[model samples]
Target: MASNAQRRDVTRERILKAAARLLSEEGPSAVTTRRVAHEAGLQPPALYRLFQDKDDLLDATAEHVFAGHLANKLTTAPSDDPVEDLRAGWNLQIGFGLANPYVFGLLLDPARARDTPGQAKGLLILAERVHRIAAAGRLRVSEERAINLIHSAGIGTVHTLLALPPERSDPHLADAAFEAIARAVLTDEPAAPAQDPAAVIASFRSLLPDLPNLTEAEAALLDEWLQR
Candidate 1:
């Protein structure tokens, strides 16, 4: 017989997988513990033992999808140009967003984003990249403004893509729009070099003292996205 820990692990995996499948098939409202258990071939109580509620399962599923997306972006290819790296990262993000629109939709939802740890990690990643750019002294605009603009554009792309009518859901059009936005934010001219994520974040941090108007949840959401 499986030990309690093993059973717990199995249940967790089952719930997450079920949530992801349902999230992809149905929308967010379709994800419930009972539905997940039915999908996983487990009793409803088994799911409750593993996750507190639907929100818990949704969070785990989002993290699982995000980790998969990040794994595809590890690059060994180095360029002396910082803008090139920034372009790579931006394009990668857009590609992932379009590829996993359902999971991406979860991240964009402000209500579901409360109490998420991934939010902070996303900011760290962005800060790391910004720091890299600052070290190269290639920033054409204030780092904070630049980071905010790029970050907002990247996020806005997801919303824009989601808003498109089914008939107009063209991935090629999405990719082209993404490239134009990335070019405008990350480079002063075409063929400019890639920047480091770290330097860009640090420079932005130095300019902003505090998020004055942002509510806790709003601030949390921003940090979560930036960390990623």
Candidate 2:
């Protein structure tokens, strides 16, 4: 017989794993209580015993996705240089996005976000981080402005990449594009000369590790400079 701790752990894992799988395949709508219970080898009645309801389950999944990310205990690596620290944080965010596109999608969905305070709170937390950095006068743009800029650009890039056919999509390319735009906007001016648009983009591509799935031609296309 499993200990109480072990039983609880097993149940939580079963729920989370089922939710993740359903979310990945069908977005949020696919994650009904019945579906999750089916996926987890639990009866619908048993699933209710585990969670309050479908909304509660969805809330838990949202929280699980953002746990280490935008929560109160945000994961910012210490850096003597503030600019570098901010850049690293941004990279970490992009990494999170790549690692969990489904959760990322849910977080960005306006309809679902309205129903989940956890997702809204996560954004507020991220905004506060930007606010703090801006208050130090260390940013090129105001904190709120900076956050809006980055947030809009990041969401746009992700959405566009996701919409493309798999043959046309390259996550590495998307990452590179975001990095370039981020560097252009975030780099301090006095220490750095005017950013060369081409150089900013090149820097983005340079940061990408080699990808196994990307074809030479597709990779080349992804690497091409953005049009004016």
Candidate 3:
């Protein structure tokens, strides 16, 4: 005989699979407690015993779906170039959202996203990728800011695509958005140019105020040279 815990696990799995099938075949409206319970070979009240309510079941379903997608993305081999890795991550996210619109909608809801463990995990994955760029000296902005910018752009892009009819959607919108974000947050070229005259002047100017060895008059003269 199966242990009680084992039976419960089997029941939960059945419920989840049933709910996911209904959601995929007939949309969210078809995934009611009654429908899922029937599909899972349980009574409607049994669903409440397993899940707190309909929303709880939905949340679990979304998390399960998103977890699979996140796993696939995480397993992908990262590119040696951090920028290229970021682009790959962006495409993966957009593709997942487009492929699973209902689950994506649930995960992408701003208010719900913070409360969802899967959604938070996804953001952390993106943040780690951004950190690599910062470490490579390719990021123009703070790591936190860059992460937020990329996250916001990705969410917006997915939502925009989801709102349109498939035929009416712009095929290049995702690539265009990513290029704009990359230009905004990444340096023009990799790892800052070697011996860039402007960068040298900027670096010198930053330390001018704190150079005790230089008198104010001398510092002023140095600043003038830096400008030239």
Candidate 4:
């Protein structure tokens, strides 16, 4: 027999699955306590035991649906080329959003994003990718700026594609958008030449903490000079 904790886990999974179905098929407004309980074969009061309220239930449902996508993202091994790896991640992100627009919208909603743990994890993954590029002396911008640009561009690409009438949709928009962001944030060549010394400085700044024999204040001052 299932233990009490095991039974609760099973019950939670059933509720989340039902809620996710309603969200995907009928949208957020349809995921009420009554409807979800019916769909999950439980009474309305059962959900209260597992979740605080309707909003809490909705947040958990979103997290449940995104779990698989996040796992897939985690499985991508880093390649020899960081640029190629980033582009792969970008393509995967766009594909995931296009394939799961309902989940994407729920995750994107600022109001509903009140309890988003997945987004934070995804940002950490992106930061690691950007850090790799900076360490390679290929990024001409700060890591924060580069991460923001890539993240914004991806979100915009998904929104653009989804907003289009099917006949007007251009599949190449994602590739073009990524290339534009790349051009804005990355140098034409690695360890950018004298004409673009910022990339080199950015590269050094990435290793600031690893440099030997530098006091905290001295490192901070050097970083300020490098940013200039």
Query: Relative to the unseen true structure, what is the C-alpha lDDT of residue 140 in candidate 2, on a scale of 0 to 100?
Result: 50
Q: Could you estimate the TM-score for every candidate?
A: 0.68, 0.59, 0.79, 0.90
True lDDT of residue 204, candidate 1: 46
> Each candidate: how many clashes?
36, 0, 0, 0
User: For model 1, how big is the CA root-mean-square deviation?
Assistant: 8.9
* Poorest lDDT segment (10 consecutive residues) of candidate 4: 187-196
**lDDT (Cα atoms) of all candidates against the true structure:** 0.68, 0.64, 0.81, 0.90
Candidate 3 structure quality by residue, lDDT tens digits, 1-228 = 999999989999999999988876787788899999999999998889889988788889888888878888888887889789999999999998888888877666666664667888898999878877765667766566688999999989999998999789899999999999998887765444463434334444545677899989999998778666
- How far in Å is the alpha carbon of 28 misplaced in model 1? 2.0
Which ten contiguous residues of candidate 3 have the minimum total lDDT? 195-204
Top TM-score hit? 4
| Pairs of residues clashing in candidate 3 | none
| Most accurate candidate by lDDT | 4
Looking at model 4, residue 18 earns an lDDT score of 98
What's model 4's TM-score?
0.90
Residues 29-78 of candidate 2: C-alpha lDDT, one tens digit per residue:
98898889889998788677678988778767766767745653465545
